[model samples]
Target: MYKSLLVTGVCAGLLAGPAFAQPYGYDDGNDRPEYARVIRTQPVYQSVRVDEPRQECWDEPVSYADPRYQNNVTAGGLIGAIAGGVIGNQFGGGAGRVAATALGAVVGANVGAGAAAANTPYVAHEGYEQRCRVVPNSHVEDRVIGYDVTYRYGGRSYTTRLPYDPGDHIAVDVDVQPRAY
Candidate 1:
């Protein structure tokens, strides 16, 4: 009877001790909170540029001449002949005068032609000309890079940034036990 009583007491004590000891449950409580269901999500964006404006310019040469100076050689010769004829008339008499006149005319004509040809004047006109070409312009705009998530758990609302959208419910682990600090 004594032995049986001792064994019974030992068994009872073991059971009661375990029951009174802190219930073997979860939370060390210092652990971080887990993710809960997402309530609302909004996309985040950033702006960027894809193209730019640039200007390019260059020069071109153009040539032209005075219309009146077109036939310099011919005009000069004619004027020279007329002048020579008058001068010869004043210098010699009869046949001698005629010969002199003829020689003078030939010499004058040759001189005039040479002078006019050598002294032909040309003008160089400089003008400014401008032209413009527009390149099709474009730019890149900010696009959604990620999502801003609002989640609810433990009867509280929380916010976070995520690379992708989490829909509806997010998984969470609960702690039945909390540690005393």
Candidate 2:
């Protein structure tokens, strides 16, 4: 009986050795296979660009002009009117000169204003948003680093420098002002 008890005690101790560090059934060891160390790291180094979400703007007071239509409206109209009147003069003479010039000016102004209007903010709340995340690093150089960090402002995913560690907090960038673009 003594010999049997000793054997049972030794077996129990051997089984429980790991439990001393953790729980009875818990395994905190990194069970990654030896080959896992040679994990293939794709050189994509790609990461979700954590940028300010695409935002929509409404018709706001003219703070600045978009370079696209700026010249078209400001100088294009005046120049067009001048050209139109000169052409008008080609058709008529004497008083026709004044009349044609005025007509050309009106047309030019209208065209210029129309061109400017093209840049008018098409204001409609079509609820547009940007996709961003609170990233710790700029990009993934080797492996697809997992990220668990969440942002408060926008629901975006960001990779952290914490080496794929779980339960890490991250931040996002979302501060776009009118005419700042």
Q: Which candidate is the best by lDDT?
A: 1
Error of 1 at 128 (Å): 24
Per-residue lDDT over 23-55 for candidate 2, one digit per residue giving the tens place of the 0 to 100 score: 222334555321101112222244555434444
- Estimate the TM-score of every prediction: 0.33, 0.26
Error at 98, model 2, angstroms: 1.8
For model 1, the stretches where C-alpha displacement exceeds 4 angstroms are 1-35, 52-136, 172-180
Candidate 1, 46-131: lDDT as tens digits: 88776776665655555555654557877888788877877876787999899889888888888877777678875545655565
Q: Considering every candidate listed, which one attains the maximal TM-score?
A: 1
Model 2 scores worst on lDDT over the 10 consecutive residues at: 33-42
Model 2 regions lying over 4 Å from their true place: 1-71, 119-181
lDDT of 1 at 118: 73
